[model samples]
Target: MSTKILICIDFSPLTPRIVKTGKELAKALNLGVHLVHAQPEKPSAPTAVVHQGADPSLGREMMKEIKELNNLKSDFEEEDIPCSYATPRGKTSDVIAAEAAKVEAPYIVLGSHGNGAMYHLVVGSVAEGVMKKLDTPVILVPAQQRLDREAGR
Candidate 1:
């Protein structure tokens, strides 16, 4: 497999910066881009019973994510970038790391929301987990920095 830059998406508004970083890296390295969006397993109500072909809500959520990924792919294509996207179902960090390995990506670019330590402890840090779990080099762009750059500050 050829080397590519993996862009991890978490449905955040900071997505553009992550994609921008991935595109720049790909352009500089003359490599392709693979966009990976991992939706975490959602907790169901205690009364909810999950069975095969039974979750209408889950289906709708999946459809929404698929549409978003397609839109992202289109954005990259418009930039004349070689881009492929996937929205895989699993733990965010695991899915992202797996995608990086699957595509043999030498570099992974993603954004950090810069939430506080308590927030991270409660919600967990996907970027941190990805960096520790993956062997590939990862670049994490901070959301505040991206915003400042965009604002010309």
Candidate 2:
């Protein structure tokens, strides 16, 4: 029985390294990856109106996620890893924690910067926010290290 893993993806530039690390780890453990994104939230009263009509906003969020998911899948499809994507709307941290709990994933993964636009998660040490709250182990990619590795600094 392979373990299930969830990674919070935001499709930012830092995503490639995060995906690479995640794929490597998942392959090592024979685990499947659940790529998740917490969609940007608009106020309920206003957005709900846009959602109520035939123009339901469900597709709006999921559509972009689906494309990004395919990109992630293709990125490692040659490696024979099983990967999928999902999006559930809610507060950022709450959504990630809830999704991880729902899947009972043995590990939860996220990039240095999650949905929080305030600051870098590890740089500002906000990665602890998820790691501390999540029962499952959380893997945070130190993307800043990439610059150092590239520049040979």
Each model's TM-score, in the order given? Answer: 0.78, 0.70
lDDT of 2 by residue, 87-110 (tens): 676767777777777777898877
Clashes of 2: 0
Number of clashes in model 1?
0
Clashes of each: 0, 0
lDDT of 1 by residue, 1-153 (tens): 767789988777888878888888887888889999886676432223353434567667667878988887887778777788887768888899999998899999988887778999898888788888977888988897657876999
Highest lDDT scorer: 1
Return the clash pairs for model 1, or none.
none
Candidate 2 wrongly placed segments (more than 4 Å):
43-62, 74-78, 114-126, 145-152
